[model samples]
Target: MDAAESLRLAARSIRGHKLRAALTALGIVIGIAAVITFVTLGASVKAEVVGQFDDSPANRVFLVATPGDDGGPPAALSQPVFTEYDVGRIGEFEGVDRVVPRGTIATSALSRGGETVARDQVTATTPALFESVTFREGGAFADASSGEACPAEMAVTPSAAALFPGNLSVGDRVSITQRGNRTRNVTVVGVLADDAGLNPLAGFGSRPRFYLPTCAYDTVVTSPTTGTRQNVYPQVTVIAANPGDTAAVQTRVQDYLDTESDAAQLAPGSYEVSARTNEDIVERIENVVDRLTQFVTGIAVISLLVGAIGIANIMLVSVRERTKEIGIMKAVGATNRDVLQLFLVEALLLGVGGAVLGVPIGVAGGWVAVTYAELPLTLPLVWVGAAIGIGLVVGVVSGLYPAWSAARVDPIDALRYE
Candidate 1:
């Protein structure tokens, strides 16, 4: 018989024993569904993380401070104190475009009406930092062009502005109190948009936040020991001249800091200066996702193995029950290859049926899980294809021994027994 005839016979046999066929296919359905669901959820989480990184500044590099050996704060003498002057010096580097110093302090805002909003995260940065962010209200960081000792001007997030008494509008003035009762009256020159893409403290739950020019921030906040106001920024963001030059610039910046005269004054390894690019962050996140996916996929593979064993068991039972029919076919005209192909087609049909049913179920389950987790919804097409292919392979391999046994049956003995 031709291959088409063999396939038709296989279908007829499957339909004839509907219960057995369904039982055989149940294993395959469960395995395929498990694999698809895990793989889809993993892909969605990875996509969400990568999307957040993509939303950040592209060509920017971050300079972060690492703790000292004892796990306490770095020794004061060894501390790499970053000031506005250091920002200017870093900006003078070959591939450096702009340098923005960043510092944060917990402060309370006292509205002009004497009402206070406390526990606000106040950031000190330059107007250049505003270039990368969106503003829901007003313009860029209020320019500190007045040359006054402290230009009391700031920008506030919508959430932060709501904390102040009265309608917080642009051009309003509020008093900010930092540690040690240091206070400064500032004008709200701008309001940050709600969707300010990746801020440093985004991982921390939502809190009131505002931005002030570095100069203004230094004036309102003073060092505990110095008793004099100085620009003490904890982190410095270096914007590379070109996106493609970030890596090279990062290297140069690191080398300069490590070997620079002022930096050399600190003890070796007293404090470590690390630079991270957007790509670096994204790569780390993807690596973590890949490891997690592999772990979950390993469990899914176990399910597939179980399904394969179940398929083999069912196919073996089918072979024994159909022995008389097999003998008759052999006696009439069927060759060993024909008997083998017939049984194999039956297994393939089971696999195809499981794949058709399981894929949709897995997709629907994945969608619900991702939605509940608040992750980006992503369809893993590659994993879907893989699931189907795995199902077919499992079916073929499971039917192999049974098919072989059927093909090798002695026609004369089988007919006499019947």
Candidate 2:
């Protein structure tokens, strides 16, 4: 018999035993579905994380202060903290476009009636900060007018505005109480839209942040030891002159910090300066997602192995039950290759049928899981093709032993048996 004739006979045999064929393909269907679901969801998660990073300014770099050996805040008096002067020096470096110093103060916001609204961390920063960070609904940073000693203008987050009795808007008054029972009433210059997805601070339970001019922040919140106003920045953000200059700018900034005058005041190894771009963070997240995808997919491979074994077992039974039929085919001028092809084609059909049902189920399962987890839906076509290919291979390999056994039966002995 030719190849086509063998395939036709295989299809007829499978149709005659519909229930048995379906049962044998069940393992394959489950295995493929599991693999596709996990792989697709993994891809979606990675994409969501990377997309968040992409939304932020790519050319901006963050510089954070290192803690002391005891895990406490670095000695404020001994260790050098970034200030406006330091920001100026950093900005002077080649390829540096701008530098914004950020200071954090813990305070409770109050209404005009003296009712407490919420306790949150307020950031004291330069107007240059508006160059990098995006606001949901605002124009520019409130001008702290050049030569002004202290400006009471402030920008409050949407979450912070919601805490007030009525809707908060520009030109409103927000009273805040700082440490040492000092209270300051500041004018609302702008309302900051929530960019939680793109802001790293959102991860640390950052309550509604209120932005204040650095000058006003110093007047209300001063250092205890000095008893004088000073800029004690815990973090500084740097914007590169151009997108392509980010790497060079980062290196120059780190090198400048090492040799800057501020370094001379610090004890050796008491503090360190580090800088990172958004791309660095994205790469780290991708690495984590890739490892997780591989681990879960490994488990799915075990399921496919079990399905392959089931296919082999069922093919063996089929060979035993059709022993007389095989002998009759051989007597009728069917070669061993023809008999082998017949069994192999039947196994292939089982795999193809299972994949047809499994792929859609896998897509649906991935969609539901990703939606529950609040991740973007990203279907990976490459993985889908791979899953189908795997099913086909498993089906063919599973039939090899049974096909060989059926082909080896002698024509004479088989024809005499009942």
Candidate 3:
């Protein structure tokens, strides 16, 4: 028989037993859907995370203090390691354009016009921190470089501004309560643009925050052992002189902290310094997502195996039921190759149908998941093609034994026994 004739015969045989064919292809549908869904979701998560850096400065590097492996509890958590002196010295390093010390102060509430919003902590950094960010209202407050002390002016993110009854604008005075019930009223000098791309220290997601000069939080972060107020920092941001020089500057900053910095001089082998760029962080996040995708994909492979077995089982039953038809076909000058082709095509059709159906289901599944999670939608088109290929291969391999059995059946016995 010709190839088209074989396809017609195979499809007619499948259509004769619609429920059985549907049941047999269910495993394949589930497997392909699962693989596509997970892979698409994984890609979307990576895209969302990496997209956060799209607006960030390429020359910015973060210097963080961590505890050494030989520690009891985390030393950096127990005591402040990076001081104002350390930040100043880093600013003087070669290839270093600017350094901003980020310190957090325990805050109770921010109040304006009898309206109050509670807060945990507020970040304190220099006015230079806002140079790269766009302002919606006023500009960045003047730093001490202008022959005046850092002013008691604050910049607020859009999320922070929304916490009040009316969105905060320039020249608005709000009372800030710090640790120990220290209340200080500061003027809102700037409101950051909505898409300000203000990356917080330690990889915290974008959220409501207010910024002031590092000096404002001096009394809030006093040294525990010394009982004295010090402008200590857990994180510092350094900017390289040029955009592409961050890697070299990061290396130098790490080496300096390890060998010559106060953290090294005061307590040797007790503190570990980390200097990382935005690209470094994005690469690390991608690696983690890739590993997780591999692990989930492995589980989906088991479902494919079960699907292949289902196809084989259904094909075997089909051969047995059509024994008389096979015998008659062989008696009428039908070749063994023709009979095998007929059976294989039936299995192939089932697999291909399952794959085609599963793709859209998987895509819808991925879309719903990402939408609910508030992440960007990313389609795994490459995986869609792979899934179809997988289905074709599965059908061919599963139908092999059944097709061979049908081809080898005795025409005389098959006709007489039935």
Summed backbone clashes in each candidate are 0, 0, 0
lDDT of 2: 0.73
In model 3, pairs of residues that clash are none
Give candidate 1's error at residue 381 in angstroms.
Answer: 2.1
lDDT of 1 at 57: 66
Which 10-residue window in model 3 sums to the lowest lDDT?
69-78
lDDT for every model? 0.74, 0.73, 0.80
lDDT of 3: 0.80
Q: Sort by TM-score, best first: what order?
A: 3, 1, 2
Query: Each candidate's TM vs. the true structure?
Result: 0.74, 0.73, 0.83
- In candidate 2, stretches whose alpha carbon ends up further than 4 angstroms from where it belongs are 64-89, 101-126, 132-154, 157-168, 171-188, 193-236, 256-274, 412-418
Pairs that clash in candidate 1: none
lDDT, residue 171, candidate 2: 75
What tens digits encode model 1's per-residue C-alpha lDDT throughout 168-238? 77888788787677887888888877734334413322456677776755433243334444565656778
Candidate 2 global TM-score? 0.73
Best by lDDT: 3
